[model samples]
Target: MGQPVLLSLLVLLAVAQGVVLAYWAIRDRRFRSAHRAARHLHSADTHAGRLALVGEIAGSIAHEISQPLSAILTNADAAENLLGEPDPPLDEIRRMLADIRRDDLRANDIVRHLHSLLKRRELQTTMLDLNEVAATALSLIQPVARKRLVTVRSCLDPMLPPVRGDAIHLEQVLLNLMMNAMDAMASNTANGAAERILDVTTDRYDKYSAAITVTDTGPGIAAAYRPRIFDSFFSTKQEGMGLGLAIARTIVHAHGGKIWQEGTSAGGAAFKFTIPLQAA
Candidate 1:
């Protein structure tokens, strides 16, 4: 009887050990599968982002090139008319040629900028002036703001120190923030009031970092949605793919910065980010 009892206890112990081992094996497999899936999804998302940026640049180039091309055609026609006459005006022809050269240069610059922005290669980091980048971004989007009746107020601190970052990525970050703010205001304008306003400011918070704030006088984000606002595919806008803020945050983080949103004093949302100041 004693031998039978011992044998039963040993069998029970072996079965328990087998069960534990099986559980661990299953858990390990699950973790590996989850990690692989996450990486695949991230890769797909990155590819999609690059494609979308390409589309945007193509559209902008089409519009930008159209203006200069039209000007070149007009100038060419004017020059031809002058030559068709018995005596062509040499000064007018020279002026027309100068205009054509200027337009060609403008077109070349646009293409170069687009190529730099759309490059899929790694970032080239260097010391960058926040005020200059902010101004350039605002200039690019001012037309959109004006069309939506949004007023932009810039308060850039000239004394701020430069930061180390990729110029193109930094510009994209600022442009995305401004466009998001403009979109938020436009939504409000469509529903009720058209009092749209955006405030973009840059200041040095301390010796260590510089801050950039994009504030909008639109409806503030709900408390429930605030936490997930930076999450991918979690946009509040109808047409938003929910990737802009996510991509912006990633870029800021890559530059050793942090991006976040908070309530503004004027009853709206404020997106603020900070980057470490470069050693002077």
Candidate 2:
């Protein structure tokens, strides 16, 4: 009887020590996370300030470049017409000129995207087609998906109603979400998984709201972390700075919408956000 009682006390003490250690570890982690979030916010603020100056400078230079770019395109067209001559096989020259024009347009598109990112304009609320925004994001990420051997599909409602928001900002939100999906699946692909897919869907929830959902076939978010997924500096990716989802949540909320995780049936992660539908 005496030996059994002593053993029971030892077991209870061990359990108590484990509980104390776990509590300490959790408190330490929370403290570290708070510090990381503070640093991230500071960095993001600094980055935004620099982008504002860049936006102004870029806006100025864009005007100057357009004139020269226009002239160059005109000259290239004339050169192509001249190369149409049936002598010396200027076909190579024509093809080279075509390539140059193609690349020039690609560069212009990149400039537009950069301008959108840097512009600090106030939210310009207007009628927006969320489906169209999702389509554009899919187009942008298609290449990345292909490179990762991931299949991306969409199931957009054909008669979805328009929502009110800044089109550029909305596009940014969808793009951020889609890119996050791709990043999440990157590990699965690296491991030579058989299948990787991302699906995006949009619909009108009612007369008042429109919704979009982005789902990925990657390792799902742990239940413990889902609540803090949108919190600043809360990241699952090793290299992620964890600002993407935070910025996304800000954009959705600014548009008078709610964003949340709806853990998927596909055993992966899904995120959805909704905005107020604009009346026709």
Number of the top-ranking candidate, with TM-score as the measure: 1
TM-score of each: 0.73, 0.64
* Model 2 lDDT per residue over 182-240, tens place: 77877785446525888999998767899999899888889899889998888988877
Residue 275 of candidate 1: its Cα lDDT? 86
TM-score, predicted candidate 2 vs. hidden true structure: 0.64
Q: Over the full model, what C-alpha lDDT does candidate 2 score relative to the true structure? A: 0.75
Pairs that collide in candidate 2 are none
Off by over 4 Å in 1: 1-47, 53-61, 146-149, 190-193
RMSD of each: 7.4, 16.7
For candidate 1, write residues 63-130 as lDDT tens digits.
Answer: 76788889999999999999999989999999999999999887777666667656654556888998
TM-score for predicted model 1 compared with the true structure: 0.73
Candidate 2 regions off by >4 Å?
1-107, 190-194
